[model samples]
Structure formats: C-alpha cells, structure tokens
Target chain A: MRPTVHHVAEEAGVSLATVDRVLNRRPGVRAKTVTRVNEAIAKLGYVRDISAANLAKQRVYNLVFIIPEGPNSFMLGLESELGQAKLYSALERINLDILKVRAFDSDALANVLDGLDLTQISGVALVATESHRVQGALARLRQANIPVVTLVSDVSAAHRDHYVGIDNVAAGRTAASLMGRFVGHKPGKIALLAGSMLVRDHVERRIGFEQVISAEFPELDCLTVQEGRDDAMVTRSVLADFLGREPGIVGLYSIGAGNRGVIDVLTSKPEYGSIAVVAHELTEHSKRALREGVFDAVINQDAGHEVRSAIRLLKASIDETQVIAKQEIIRIEIYIRDNLP
Target chain B: MRPTVHHVAEEAGVSLATVDRVLNRRPGVRAKTVTRVNEAIAKLGYVRDISAANLAKQRVYNLVFIIPEGPNSFMLGLESELGQAKLYSALERINLDILKVRAFDSDALANVLDGLDLTQISGVALVATESHRVQGALARLRQANIPVVTLVSDVSAAHRDHYVGIDNVAAGRTAASLMGRFVGHKPGKIALLAGSMLVRDHVERRIGFEQVISAEFPELDCLTVQEGRDDAMVTRSVLADFLGREPGIVGLYSIGAGNRGVIDVLTSKPEYGSIAVVAHELTEHSKRALREGVFDAVINQDAGHEVRSAIRLLKASIDETQVIAKQEIIRIEIYIRDNLP
Candidate 1:
C-alpha cells in the first residue's frame, strides 16, 4: 500500500502544510519538525511520486527582473543572461518577465515597482535605485507578500529580501590596492573617476578606495573624484581636462562604467604609458583595453552571475526555501592581461 | 480540453520518447526537434504539471562524493559543504553518499571507483588523483552509463563528464601576478612550494606561475618547487630548510595546502616582513596570516561552490540535461586581507 502525505502528517503529529513544506524543501518549518516528518515517512516506507505531486499542484513562479535600460555593456549582459534564463523556463518552471526602466531615475523605478500586481508576480528582482520612493514601493511589495531582491547596486532603505551583488566597498579597496601595488611606492598623483555619488555602490566604493589608499599608500596623492555620469564623451572630456591639469597623475582608478571614456583619453595620449590604470566592469571596451596595455587591471563582477543569482534568490524566496549563501555570493573578480578568461 | 503527451507527439510528428525528452529537458534531443515539440505544445495549449509528473516517476539520484581524508582545512571544508548538501537531499531527491579514500593515494582512489555499484549509484563526484588506473576505472563507470565528475584536482585522462574546479593555470598565473606586483621590481629569489607535481592542478599551477614570472617579472627569480606532500610537519621542515639555505628568498608561492607550515616558518622569522607571500585556499590559518600581514594574498576557490557545482554537473549529466556553461565555470578568486568573504 502506498503511504500518503496524510499518513506521514498523522504519524509526525504535524499540520499538512508543515509536511508539505518539509517535502517541498521550503523554509519556515522547524528542523525538529522536519526531522519528525522524515522519520515518519521512513517508518511508513513512503515514496513520493514527485512528478504526480508537482503536476497536481502545477507550481509556476512568476518572476520579474527590473533592469535599468542603458547602452552600458554590463546592463546589456544582465538582460542577455535573463533572456537565457527565460529560455530554460521549461526546466526551472519559471515565468520570467523583464521590465526596463529609465537608468538612474528613482521616480521611474518607483512607479514601476508600485505598478506591479503582486498577485501576478510572485517575486521581483531589481537593480534598485536607493531612494525614499523606491523604498516605499518595495515596502508595499513586502506587505503584499511579494519578495523583492536588489541586484548590482543595493538599496539599504528598501525591504529587499536579499542583495545579489558584490561588496562595492571591497571592490573599491581592491582597486586601490592594485593601484598602489602597480604604482610601486612611486610618489605621484592618482586620479579617481566615478559615475556619481548618488548611488550607494559608487559612494561605498569611493569610501573604501579612500580608506585603503590613505592607509597604505600615503606617498601617493589621491585627488578628488570627478563625476562623468558614466557617459563616454563626458568621461573623455572630463578626464582629458583633468590629465592636462595634472600631468603628474601616474595612476588612474575609474570605478564606474565610463571605462570607454577613460580608454579614449588614455589612447589619445599614448605618451602616458607608464600610468597605472585600473577600472571596473569587464565589458568589450575594458577587455580590449586590458589586452592593449591601456588598463593594468579590471575589477569585474560577472553580470551573468548577478542576474542568475538574483533569479535564484528570488525563486528561493518565492519557494520559502533557504539558498546556499556561499553559492549565491557574487565575487569581485580581478582580471589582468595574462588571465583574461 | 487540455493537451496530453500523445497530442504533443502527434503534433510534432515525433515519438512519445522524443516529446518526453524535450519535456524533461534532456540533452539527447536535437534543438530543432525540441523547438518543434515546444511549439506544438504551445499550439495545443499543453500545460505540464511538472511536480506531479516528477512525483509519479519518484526519481531519486544516488550520488557519491569521493574526497581525500586529511586535516587540511580546504578538504575539511569540502566535506562540510558536502554534508550540507546531504542535508538538503530531501528536497533535491538526491541520496548522497560520501566515500573518503586515503589522501593522495591513486590506488586507493582507483579501488573505490572500481568498487562503485553502478546499479545503485547514478552519478559520482570525486577529487580525482590523475593516474591511468583511475582513468580506467572512470572509463568503466562511463561504460556502465554512470556519469563521473572530477572535483578539485582534475584528471584529464579520465572519461569524466565534467571537471568542477577552476583553471589551475589561471589561478597560478593570478598568484604570480599578485606576487610580482606586490614585490615590485625588488631583485630577489622566490621559492615555490607544493604538495606534489603528480597532481594535475599543482603541475598546471607551477607552469602558469613560471610562465608569468619569466615573461613579466624577470627581476624576480622564482626557484624550483619543493614538494612537501601537503603534510603540515613535512611542509614546515622543508620550508624551514629552504629558508635556511636561501636567506635571500624574498617571495614564497605555496601553490598547495600546508599553509600552516609556511606560517610557522614565517612567524619564527619576523624579519621576513619584506617577503611577498602568496598561497592558495582561504582557511583559518591562511585567513589569520592575511589579517596579521604575514601573508600578502590568498588564492581561494570556495569549497561550497565546488561541491554544489559538482553535484549540479553530475545531476545534469545523470539527467542528460544541458547546463549553462558560464554558470559552471568555477572562478579563480584572488583574496587580499581587505576582501575576505
């Protein structure tokens, strides 16, 4: 005779939901209760007909990824990975919906978040802009029983279930360390480039970079950061002007997506070959730059990793399952010319 | 009326097995066939209750992890992660069995592989010793339709389905670059330490370290590798002897375990502060060393990541499913004191 879930529940002296949660690997059930349920099943010699059970329930996770619409290679890569994830919907049982909002526009992001029908979307994964409006929207989603996970740049104010990205502060420290090591105690001015101070990631990176550089390489002077809004032309123009003003700058740390601009400026002045340059994101431009010796190192977080991690986290949240923390950590990868891949 | 598997098969002009293959996300079906089947299902408005279907099948994967028994923190970490994975088997439908062979013993590993009951075990993940005997055993497993995935140290000669570890060459190159950059242009000899050259990972790392050091930092002379067999006491004795013999050695690249031994040698001689040290695996000893400024850098591959990856890869192989390549590529992580975990 086939032992049913009811039998196991009765033997375990637990509710049906508890048994189901244990069976489904969902969180919320106590470890002792889970053990009891398993022991009861073992005693009954119960074998789960997983296919029939899943077919009976017809579980499908309706997940949405809110990405900032941009020409940035990193964002594009994220979108591409999401598309790939969507293609595996049959296996994952995920209905992945992608929404693109205005990049860096908090109002636009908030509106999108507020507009989401929680009944329709079981989970939301977004590259959030940290703002009061965004926070309010995320709080609303949480209240409505919808899980929200922040990606790439995290939002502290939001009720986000998890953050699927690297530590920006650590990333910055790594950049500074690389710059210090590459420059080799040579007393020279170091230039810092960023998109803006509005984003938490950029701000944290700036703070971390400053902390490391000031402590370790006091001989080298790190100048004030120049915000180029991550625009290539703006970055190029600003960097060119800065380079002209500070010809003594022997190291450059571009901790943003405006690497093309940095590369353009560096390419125009080939005579500054000795300048040790480190940038963020391994985009096509940066990869090429690393190969050509325009950039000494690129501190990158794989966009694919971020997107997949967000999806996994959101799905786990939806399933009420515990995700392996170590598996979910997006690494701050350092790439040099020799080890590009 | 809902569509059934028969309807899908008829619509796609394929067999029931082909439809099942496509529906199960198995690898054997052609892409065009899968697309046709999927299109047919969509056209017929077919919705599969995947959980119920899987439940009906009652599929359970009996997998094994073959690890080396040692006090080495990295190996212990791997075992711990595997234990965690086993705890989640109720959800993954995996019956995980762990087999610990004698450390670094090719014959012991080969015997274990040869002894596996293919009828009971669906897949195997092993920290393989690269030997002809092991390869032959792996070939037998393949012949019996049992999938094998090599973890940590890989065996290229085996008929293993996949290797779930980072590129050792890239890791060694990264270590060398960090050591070279950290040491600057200071002219001094660098000592290389390893467990054994017999393992593919150590040999590859040695080659990569040598390649980068010779090409980029010709000023720093990297010495021949001293095999310590990964035993702490042996590593300590060998390193102590080497330090005594070459007092001018300014850099140490310990490409294997036995970091504790290295730390012991370094701790005794406080004047070796100028010596740039780079080692692999982030363990308690190494982490403490990094924090104390005794070690400059640690190249680590997450044990949890490796275990989970090996399981995923093996499971996919057992299911004959396609895996996302980018997700499967284990990263070569470079850890400084600033960015630990």
Candidate 2:
C-alpha cells in the first residue's frame, strides 16, 4: 500500500514523463512543474523505488581511488579492501578504478589528478600529497561538480568535499599520552620517528606529540625527529644510528610507517626492549611487536573503514542523500597486546 | 544490458514463476530446479538486484529488538539508535519493534520471548540475561527457524546466529592490562565492580580480568566484587562503604554500568581521585569523567555500531546473504582524555 511514482503523478495531475524527469532530477522539467511534482510526492508520501529507477536508467557511478604506490603495508591493505569492495560493484552499480602515483611525489600525484577525464569519472578519492599543484587539481574537480574525498593524508581542506580518515592530531596526542604513562616518572628522553615532515599527517602528528609531551610529561624530553621516508632499510639504519647516539633514551614513538625498523632495533638490542615504545598503524610487524612487548601500544585507523567511508560519502554526494554522521566518524583505534583486533 | 528475470528463466529452462520461487526460496520448486536456476544464475553472472527483488515481492521484514528496560544510559542509547534506524525503515523495508522487559529479570525476559508470535516475526535481537528459562525460549525460536542475534551481551553459543558485540573476555583482559600498567608497580588492592555475576558478559569479563591480574600484576590483588545492580544510588552507597573499608585500593575496575555513581563518589572524595579507574561504555558521565581525569581509561563498545551491526546481521540472515565480517566486528574501543571521540 506504499505510495509510488504513479500515485505522485496522479496527485500532481502531471504526465508520467514529466514525473520521471522531476523524480530523476533530469533537465526539461520546468521549475514550477518540479515544485508541483515534489509537493505531490510529499503529499502522497511517495517513497521512490531507487532500485527500479536505477535499473531503468542503468546508472553506474565510476569512482577513482588514487593512492601512493609503495610497500607500505597499510596502503597495500587499503588496496586489497578496494578489491574486495569491487565484488559488490555489480550489485551496487559502481565501477571503481585505482590510480597509483609515486609515494610522496606531489608532481606525479598532481599530474595524475589533472589528467582524469571529468566526464568518465563521477568521483575521486585520494591519499593527497600536500602541494599547490595537487590542491589546484582538486579544486578543478570541485569546479566540475565532481565529489572528492581525501583518504588517509589530506591536502588543503577547502579543495576536498570530505576527509575519510582519523584526526592525525588526536592520534599523535593519544600516542604521547600512552607513551608518557607507559614510561612513568623516570622518563629521560623520548625518541621521535616519522616518515617525513613534508607530509601533513606526519607534521600534524609531530605537533600534537610535542604539545602533549611539553605540557604533561615534564620529566621526559623528545629527541630530534628522524625522517625515515617510510623505507624499511633506511629506517633501520637511521634508528640504529639514532639509538646508538642517544644514550639516555627511555622511550620511542614511531608516528608513521617504518614500524618494522623500530621493532627491529628494539628487539635486536636487549637494552632497548625496556624502552616503552608506541607506534602507529597495525600491521604484521606491529602486531608481533605488541605481542613481544617491543611496542607498548599502537594507534590505528582502520584502512577498511576509510575505504568504505569514502565510497559511502561519494555515493551519498552523487545521490544527494544524507549519511549517518555518527557512523562516518572514523575513530582513532588504540590497540595493546590484550586487545589486538 | 544486465540480465533480467526473463533471461534467468530462459537460461534455466524454467518458467519465470519457477525462477522467482527458486530465487525467493519459496516452496513448490523441486531441488533439481533450484540447482538448475542457481547454476544458470552463476553461469550468467546474474547478481540479484536485492532492492528490486524486495520491492517486487513487497518483502517487509518484521524484526523485534528485545532489550532490558531501565535507566541504564548504555541501553537507553541503544534504544535511541534503534529509533534513529526507524527513519530508514520505509526505504530499507524493515519494520522494527522494540520489546522491553525489566532489567536483569530472567522471568520477565523469558515470558516476553515466549509470547512473540513467531509467524509474524522475521528475526529477533536481544541484550540477553543468562538463565535456563531464556535459553529454552531461544531454543524454541531456533526450532521454529527464527534468526536471533545477541546484542551487547550474549548467551550460550548454540542459540544465536550472530553476536553483534565485542568479545567481553578480551575487553576485560584489556582493562586489566591498562589497570596494571596505570597502577604501576605499587602494591595495592584493585576494587572490582559489577552489575551482576548472573549476566554472561559480566561473568566472562571478571574471569578474564582475574586471569590477567593474577598472571601479570603480582603486586596488585583484586578485592571481592561489589554488585551495584547498575543503579546509581545503590552504587553510591556500596562504593562509599567499600572504599571506606578498603583503604589500600589503588585501582577500580567497573565491569558494568553505574559509572555515574562511580564518578560522583570519586569526584566527591578527593582522596579517590588518584585511583586509576577503568569502566565500560562511553556516555556523557564517562566522557566528563575522562575529560576531568577522574577516570584514566574507558573501554567502550559503541552502542551505535552494535545496533547497526545487529540490524545488518538480522537482515542478512533473513535474506540468506553473506555479511562483510570485518564491517560487523565490534571493536573493543579504548578511550582516554586525548582521544575522547
């Protein structure tokens, strides 16, 4: 007994073709006609059968996910999740394409973004590299009325419609708090490790970490940040040298990828095992590190959640629908040895 | 063009009626015919247009959410989420009915379960109270081929199709780990609070908490549990009396509700402010306590996530469809001052 398009058309005294145009937001319907149809729909309590409408129209959203190409386990996992989402692409009427650019290369990322054909692409999600060129590309997409969601790392906020990731500042603050508590009152020096200062997430994390350490943990002091560029070998060499030089280091905070290097350094050196370590992201390396007591805590943002949230946001924007705000807030997940999953 | 029902019928060498019967799992179709139809579907890669199929069949799922009625903030939050879900009922074709019974009253819960008209109900979800009477009712529902999902709390494993909540044991273990670390190496007693040992989640949490405390924290001892029945007034009186007598208590683990009372007692008595407190669920009271440094950490299973997961599980069960396992996992979230959200 639910009201349908036919009921709305009958109530509005409009032709079926005009009702279809109004319902689909298609051009050719006059503003007055659209208003009349909408009023009729409201009056009749007509709930559009979205499935049938899509079926008749054969509407398929073509979305692109752009990410850095590298051995970063987190990004790889995200790529896998996107692949899994493709399994439902037929059912959801979505066509997903992934574009990979060199890691941390703003020029490459910008070129890829600028080259995208707006006509072929309905939406875009990217792990943005912060730069004016990239921002300009995002703004162009926005100008073309294409929805854009920034995943993981974000550029200028104004260019993106939504950001599907955790608050990096809060994540860093949480890590600092956990590091402070785990190290206790006898903390001497805390070693800071990051991917790069150029990356906005890393910079934001460093800001928050320094803010907490200086304000709360007066006994502890952070050593100079070592930018490992998220390369495992480079990170391993850098950490080894840093720890060797820093004698009074009582704690370590790995604020980005390259946890493997941190774990390697901690596990190989028995003395450093007692140094309370906090890291970001949950990977095979981090999980093992947590279990073996090398890493005291891990701050994680679920990649699966980010990928799915981006898809949902893009779809909602395309459909002009409201998403559940509470559900979309990606939580900063904290994990220890006891609660791994 | 996407394959239609007519295409499926033609490929299966059957009538459209037979294909419909097979797809909907209705009676009158032979097992051989069902297999043929399924094989044809697979061969043609015919993804079912679930929304269209549901619309065509006018399939409105009638689901019942049976939860304990009380002043418990967590339960109230869950109820509110259910109410929010009602907004999408027409679009999703789900009729959700909430049935509330007295909190912790096994007889009342069992009677309500037994009284449900099975013919009219598509699925059931409940915050279970462990008891033989309730188990029998669940068994009867299973016998009648009804899908049941346990929310927040779970009963015996065999009775429910899915559990849309975090692992209570792991949650308890995580709490103990945090408590032990936060309390440090100082030798003191850790007071344990519970709603009741009759509830399965509470009992399991206690068991896990004890296991970790005994195995790891040799300096700390858990005092006898104090059941407050999750009532603010009763918890206030019990905690006041308990803290007065238990002078050496350095940490408090609240395994269940009544956190408002815990907050009131801790804030009122400045002496108890230094005590490392860990409690379950995130509410206004818990958020305030966390922000004020009255509670060190909060172990939360998001009520919104649990409700959405339960609904998804129920619908998937009704439709005989697969659910994304990762999306359904209710993570044991650890909240601190820095990561309040």
Candidate 3:
C-alpha cells in the first residue's frame, strides 16, 4: 500500500493538521517539528500526488510565452499552436498568456521581461535574446523564484531553467547529412541560407551543417552563407541572383524561416528542382513545396510539441518536482513528401 | 469571476447536497432535478474541472494495457515504455496494469478480454487481433461502457474507442519512398519483409509501400514479400536466402520487428552494404545498425509516445471529455543516422 499523509503523521507522532502544514509548505510550524515530519516522510517513502493536491487546494498556474511579433510563418505557427494549447489546458487551470515583443529586438525583450508582474505569474517561456540586459532580467526572475524556459532561439548564457526545443546544431547536422546522401556521390558545390548569424539557432545550424559537410563529404564544396534576414522577398531575390552566378551549385540548405522565398526561386526554374533542396519547418508552404517536388526534404520541430513541452516544464518547475528528461525531449523531425503529415 | 457550484445550485433552484448528488451522478437524484442541474451547467457555460473534482472525490483510474508477450524487440520496447509510464503516472492516481498473453494468440487475447472485471477496471488498451472472437469480446467490453484503445496493431473492425499508434500504411509508404530515393535512379529490384500478413499493421504497410513504388518509381520493381513470423533467426535465414537468390536486389524494406535478423544478414556480407535498407522501430539494435551504416533509415512510432497517448485517451474516455486529436496523434517518425535521438 502507498503511504499517505496519515502515515506520515503517525510516523512523526504529530497531529494531522500539523502534518498538513508541513506538507503544504505553509508557515507557523516549528522548525524542529518540520524536520521530524520531513524525516518521517523520507522514512515512509511517501510521494505526494502533486496534481491532485494542487487541484484540491485550488492552485492555478499563470504562464506566459513571450514570442516575437513577426510575419514569419514559423512564429505564426507557434502562436497558433500556443492558442490551441491554451484552450486544451483550460480545465487544468493553466492561464496561458502570449506576450509579443518586436522581433529580434533585445532591448524590447528586456523591457518586456522587466515589466512582468512576477507575483501574479507562475512562470515564463520566452524566445530569448543574447543581450546582457535580457540575461540580467532573467537572473532577476530566477532570484524572484519564477522559472524561465527558453524556446526555439535560446539564450544559453541566461541560465534558464530549461530549453523546450530541438537542438539546432543537431538539426543542422541532420540536414547536411540528408543533403549529402540525397545528392549521391556527386562532387558539387553546396550553398547555405540563413536568417542571420546573430541568432544563436541559425548560427548553430550553420556551424553543424558546415562541420558535417566538411567531415563526411569532402568532395562537396560548401560556399559562404547568404543572409536572408528571414524575409521572403529578400530570400527570393538573393537566392535567385546567387543561383544565376553559381551554376555549379548542386545543393541548397535553408536553415531558417524564408522557405517561401527559397521555394519561389526553386519553383520558377524547373532545373533548380534537380538540385537537392532542404529547408526547415513544416508550414503550409513548405508542405506544399515538398509535395510539388520543389523541396526534397524538411527538418521540423513540431510547434505543438514545443508549446506543450514548455508548459510541462514550467509546471514542474513551479511545483518543485522532477522533470522526466526523456519524456520532455522535443524530437527533431524529418519529413519528405511521403512522410508529410 | 468563474461560475461556482453555489451559482449552479442557485441557478438550478437546488440545495448544495442535491447539486453534489447530480454532479456525482449518484443514485436517488430525481430525473427532473438532474435535468435542472444540467440546464444550469449549460446556461452558465460552467466547465467542471474534472481533475479537481476527481481529486476531491478520491477517484482512481484502474487502466490495463493488454500487450503481447514476446521476445520481439519492438513489443519488448513497448512493454518497457509502458512500465515506465506506469511509474510516471503513479502520482496521477492512475493504476496502470500490464496483462500479457501469448504473442499473436487470438484465443488467448479473447479469453483475457472476456475475463476482465469491468467493475474494477476503468479502461483498457490492447494490441488487438482481427478475429471474430476478439471482435465479439471487444464489443461486449464497449457494451459494458468500458473505453478501449487499440495499440500498435489495430482492430479497426472492432470500432475501438481510439487508436494510439502510427498509421501503418503511411509508415510503409515513407519507408518505400526513402528506399527508392536513397538507391538513386538505378532500376533495381527491392525486397520486402514482414512478420506476418495476418497483422493489420504489416499488411497496411505493404499496401502503402507498393502503392508508392508503383506510382512514383516505375523503374524500381518490388519483389514478393517474405514473412519471418517476427523471429530473428527465421528472418536472418529467409533474408539471407533471398539475397543470395536475387542478385538484382538493391534495396530492402523490412516492415516489421525482426530487424536484428535483417542486420545480421546485411552485416555478414559487406557487399550488401551498397543496398539501402529501411526498417521499423528504433530499438538499441536498430540504433546501432543505423549508426554502423548497416541500416540506412528507420521509420519509428515512439513506444513511449504510444503508451502515453493510450493513457491520455483512456482517461479522457472515462471522463467523457473531448480528446485533442492533434495532441493525441502518434507521429510517423523517420530516422536516418544523423537524426536518430
């Protein structure tokens, strides 16, 4: 039989109400008595059913996902997914709020972070910036005992509680490996496109891609990356001009959110389809391009998984419970036309 | 402010105890009083926090997963995942029980289903056999108002409440597509292997694979399927014999759980490494084979994901709550060595 609060009370030789105070972390219990109850708890190996206890106590979690305000398809998808998650978690008493800051603005993110009412909010999940100001804000939040989870683009220097996204470096390496294999023994030049090197996720992906291409496919020449700034028009014009100048480019890897632009350039020229093209995310546009044979493969991190994972991590952190690392892992997904969902 | 039980009682013109009786669906509540309470619930748009109410009432879910007992790595992996899930859900007041019968024994499965004590069990998740007896057993369980979820191999004819696994047909098509692409434009024959055609999952995968191969890659000829009955030794000998007899075979798609046998044959003959091999599941053996370059790709339905999804579906079914279809979906995951987690 499992141990209960009564068991702990009996073992500690304390009243049920006194045991409840210790169990709930409520004040007014003597320090020595608290120690006795804790020892009894350890002896009995009692585990409190956190969700049930929280529910009975009418504990509600107020969470916020601070995302970037943008027209980026990936961010839009993330917002849509977060909205759905909020609806799904209504009964769980999780009030999920989405806060948007100007895209890529470190100061704007820091300002938002500073303005947060920590007393009312249980936890925060954010797309973090690398700026020291953001890091300082994160440290303050931590000091205040509110947990912070970094989302897609991480600010590792901030010492966040958890990261709720795929490993961008691994994702990039996987893309490079796919590009190398799909191109099949051909010695040709490969081009890479990214949003910007300033963003950690894109930079990590670029680093991973270059490493694999150099180590595994020495025959393949990797050209310098072109920054698209995650803008569709910029990606299209820049890629089209590059393709015209480099006829020898046999493969292209787009490691950011300008796939629409990449797809436009590739679809306009039927010859470009013969070149191995790989991109990130599985938005409606990417899905269609893969189906139309404009893109060979896609590397994806499910937005739903990311949002849901963030919620779980934040709740566990708030409850001071152990997180199941393996269960919380957000997978790096690969999609081809045949496997697209 | 959110509507409370007091508000509900006031709206229904009922006493607090009467409201409790109606909410709990207890005996002795008049039908007219029940109707009044339900009308109040709808009128106020009051959504009951099921988890909270269940906690207050100390409701515990007794769930059983009827899995096939086998040496098959994938089934073993599923069992292991379920065990871990049971541990994880201990705090959720979920008592998850695993009932094992002889692998692929329809009568044994039917007998187990027949013997279920519905009074004690809240719900069941099972890997079902497509037999009249099994279907009849499932029908009786449903008639008893027990929620049933089909896992891994599905029993579609039984009209199970939910399916907590990948779409086998889609998984097969994905494998075929990867095989065709990885092997390049060479017009070579491909070999297909399976546990048994009697299993719905295997048969669906075969159908999906053949459909894609026939439609997209007319150059590649698909050879007849060989069943290994999910035995590693049987798979090894059969595949080794087939490889010897068919020199034109350039790719092999193993659609079932005997990948160790497939890997044994392939690794023994270094020359066979040229053939692109794709299979199912990501067991330790498959992971090593993929890393060692013996297997090119693996199509996976995460065992952990399946077990968790089954639990969620069963709990939701018991509560008569809406299931989030997207969140519950078990992804048809594709893994190459680069992306294997």
Candidate 4:
C-alpha cells in the first residue's frame, strides 16, 4: 500500500493542514516549512497523490502554445498533434488556448503576449526569438512568477525551465553518418540545404554534420550550404543552379523543411532521384517522396512529443519539480525506403 | 466563461442535488432525470470542467496494464516509455499497476483477471487474446460495469471499450511501398520475416505487404514468410539457413522483434550488409546497424503514446463515452539516414 498524506504529515512532524498547504503550494507557508515537507515527501517516496492534491487545490492550469503562423509542415504537424493530444486525457480540465503568431516576427509575438491575462494564465509555451521585447516579456512573466517554456526553437539562455525536443547536433551527426554510408563507397560531393543559418537547430545540425563527415568520411567533400528560407521556389531554383554547377553531386542533406521543393526539382531532373537525398519532417510530400525513392531518409522529432513534453515542462515549472531529461530527449528517426514506419 | 453546475441545473429544470447526482454518476438518479440532465449537458455545451470535477470527486482511478512477458526489445521499450509517462499528469491522479504475464498463455492471464477487484480497479487495459476464461472475466467486469480497454493486440471478439494502437496492415503497406521504391529498377528478391503468424499484426502486415508489392512492384518477388517466434537464437539460425538456400535476396523485412538476432547474423555476413534491410522497432542494435551500413530503415511506434493512450481509453471506457479514433490511432514512423527523427 502507498503512503498517505496522514503518514507524510506524521513523518514530517507537521500538522495535516500545514502539510497540505506545502503539498498544494498554498500561500503563507515559509520556505523552511515547505522544504521540510518536501524532505518528508522524498524520504517517504510519496509520489504526489495528484487526485487528492488536485481535489484540494483544484489547479486548472490555463496553458497557451504561441504557435508560429507559417505553412512550415513541421509546425503545422505540431499544431495538429497538440490538438489531437487534447483527446488523450481529461483535457477538459485544461483551459488550453493556442495563440498563433508570425513565425519570425518577435514584435508580433511580444505584442500578443503582452495582451494576455498573465495572472490567470498559468504558463506559456512558444517557439521564441531572442529579442528585447521578448526578454522583457519573459522577465515580466518571471516577476509575476509564471512558468515559461519554449518549443522547437529553444530560448534556454533566457533561463527557461526545460527543453522538449531532439538534440539537433546529434540528429545532424546521425544524418552525416547516413549520408556518408549510404552513397556506398563513392568519393563524391555532398550538398547541404538549410532554411536559414540563424535558427539554433539548423546551425547546430550543420555543425554536427560537417564535424562528423569531415572526421570520418573525408573522401566526400561537403559543399557550402544554401539557404532556401524553407521556401519551395527558392529551394528549387537554388538546387537547380547548384546541380548545374556541381556535376559530381552524390548526396543531399536538408536541415529543414522545403522538401516538396527539393523533391519537385529532384524528380523533374532525372538525376536527383537516383542520387542519395535526405531531408527533415515526414509530411505528406516527404512521405510520398520517401515511397517513390526521391528522399533517402527523414530525420524527425516527433512533433507530438514536443508538444506534450512542452506542456509537461510548463506545468513542472509552475510546480517547480525536476523533470527527467532522458525520457524527454526526443530521438532522430532514420528512414530508408524499406522500413518507413 | 464556461457554464456552471447551477446553469446546467437551471437548463435541465432540475435541482442542484439532482445535477450533482447525475454528473457524479450516483445511484439514486432516475433514468428519465439522467436523460434530462444529459440533454441539458448537450444543450449548454457543458464540457465538464475536468480538473474541478476530479477535485470534487477526489477519485483516483487504479488502472492496470497487463503486458506479456517477452524479451522483445519493443516490449522493453514500451515499459521504459511507461516509466517516463508516469512522471507526467497520469501518475499524479491515477494509480497504474503493470502486471507482466507470459505471452500466449491465455489460462494464466484469465486466472489473473478473475482474481482482480473491479470495484477498486476503476479500469483495466491489456494485450488480450480470444479465450473462454478471459471472455468470462471480461463479461463479469462488464456486469460490474468496469472499463476494460485493449492495447496493441486487442481482442475484438470481446466487447472491450476501445483499442489504442496503430493500423499494422497500413504500416505493412507503407513498408512495402518504401521497399518497392528504394530497390527500384533492380532485379531483386525480397524476404518477409516475422515473429509469429498467429499474431494479428504480423498476419495483417503480411496481407498488406502482399497487397501492395504485387500490384505496384511486380518485378520484385516477395519470397515466402518465415516465423522466428520472437526468439533471437531461432531468428538468427532460421535467417542464416534461409540465406544459404536463397541467393539473390536484395531486400529484407523484419516485421517484428528479435531484431538483435537478425542484425547479428546479417551484419556477420558481408554479403547481407549491401542488401536493403528494413525492420520494425528501433533498438540499440538497429541504431548501430543503420550507422554501420547493415540496416537501412527502421519503422517505429512510440510505445509511450500507446501506453498513455491505453490508460485514457480505459478511463473513458469506464465512463462509457466515445473516444476520438483519429487521436487514438498511433502513426507509423518512417526513419532513414537523412531524416532520422
């Protein structure tokens, strides 16, 4: 049988109500008292009796995911996954509000965030930028003692509580390893494609890719990266021009979305499909290309996990508990034509 | 702002006590009164404020997951994912008990189910089989009005509340498409290896594979099915023998677990490394093989999602409500070298 609140109270040598206050995060409990209660909790291995604690606290965290207003397949997939996650548990208990804003416009994000009822809003989870207005808003939220979490685009330097996505560097390394091995002992040039170099994920991925490929597979020369801004037209034009210049293009590593654009150009010009191609995000277009042998592998971070993990982290920040990192560390999926899940 | 109990009572033309009784599923409410309350609920769009409702009821659902005891990497991963999920919202309010039993042992499973307390255990979720004893226990639970949800391997014969997992047949078809596309324009033979023919997923996958490959990629000859019984040694030996008999094996599809064994044999043989190897469940071995150019692609199901989904389904089943099938349906994840997320 699990230990009850009464047992914890007795062990802590505190009154039942005082223990309740500490456990429920009620006001007027000193830090010392809270610490003692927590010590008792740890000693007893008392997994928080959430149902009983919730009964007393009735904490319905009003959460908001400030999604970017872009047609980025990954972000769209994230939004859809979040909406679907609502059907998972007692989601009605959550007052979830999705605040969609421009993907790269920090001013727009700050403007919208400033207008929300911060007191009533328990936490905020968003893909953010490192701008003054954003930092100021975060500071304000911190002053108000509200929890803040970042999604795909992390703002951990802002002292955010947790990050709930894949390690972009590891993903990049994995990509390089595949890019090196899959070309089958061929000494040729590999081209890397990215949306933008500014975003931390893309930057980290490129670094990892370069580091691995250079150290292990030196025979393959990695060309300079081309920025497509995740746009199909830009990708198509840029890739077409690059292919024309470099005839020995043996492999392609895409660090971001613009897969549809790449696929269109790859299949249209007969040589691209036969060459080893890799990209990110398993969208409708990517899935099709993977099936039809245009793209070789898709390194993906389960958008659903990211959404759910961000929520959990936000809630944890509000609650101030240590979250296990390994469980939340998202994996990079490797896809070939034969074993696409 | 959402409607309150008072508003619901007013809308239903009932008293506060009656509304409480109906909402709480108390025994005293009349059938006609319940119907009226339900009508009012629908009319007001009174989504039960779940946090507050849980607070008022102080109900802690004791949910159980009866997983089969096998050394399958997939099952271990499922358990690990379960451990991770426990840190989130589910553990706070729900008491989860995982009872590991031997797979394909209907008698033991039925016996175990018989002794359980439905009153205390609000819901039950398991990988069930079609058996008289198991059915009898489920019938008893139904009589007692307990919710029983089926997980990955569901017993459709038993009227369980919900099923929480992926469409294996569709996954198989997707795998087939990938295989057909990746091994394009090459004169090659493929092999379908499975754990057991009796398992629903393996059977369905075989059907789906045959369905797609025959119609789309007629040039690729999918060879006969082989069962490993999910045993490592058996799989390694069987695959090794099969390779001796069949020479032009260009494609390999491992439909189920015991992948380490497959990798061991395949990686040891220099001839097998060049073959397009596709398999299910991403384990340490698979990750290594992909890196070293042994395995090509890995199809995965997020065990965590499936476990969490099962628990939610069980809880919802106890309430006798509709579940969003789209949300519950776990997706098929395709992994390759380039986009390995």
RMSD of each: 4.4, 1.8, 2.1, 4.8
Prediction 3 global C-alpha lDDT: 0.89
Predicted complexes: DockQ each: 0.46, 0.70, 0.63, 0.24
**How far in Å is the alpha carbon of A150 misplaced in model 2?**
0.4
Residue-level lDDT for B106 in candidate 2: 88
Worst lDDT 10-window in candidate 3 chain A: A49-58
Q: What tens digits encode model 4's per-residue C-alpha lDDT throughout A285-326?
A: 898898787887777777877877777777768766767565
Docking class of 3: medium
What overall lDDT goes with each candidate model? 0.86, 0.90, 0.89, 0.79
Alpha carbon lDDT at B246, candidate 4: 97
Candidate 1 C-alpha lDDT tens digits along B208-258: 999999998999898889998887999999999988898788899999998
**Runs off by more than 4 Å, candidate 2:** A13-17, A27-34, B6-18, B25-36
Interface RMSD over true interface Cα atoms for each candidate: 3.2, 1.2, 1.7, 5.0
> Per-residue lDDT for A324 in model 3?
69
Report the candidate with higher DockQ, 1 versus 3. Answer: 3
* TM-score of each model, in listed order: 0.90, 0.97, 0.95, 0.80
lDDT comparing candidate 4 with the true structure: 0.79
Estimate, for each residue in B53-163, the C-alpha lDDT of model 4 and write its tens digit.
665666677887788888888888877777666556455477788888887788888988988977688888888765878888888887888878877776764557776
Question: What is the two-chain DockQ of model 4?
Answer: 0.24
By TM-score, the best candidate is 2
Per-residue lDDT of candidate 2, residues A91-188 (tens digit): 78888999999999999999999899999999999999888898888889999999999999976779899999988999899999998899887859
lDDT of 3 at A39: 99
Can you tell me the CAPRI class of model 2? medium
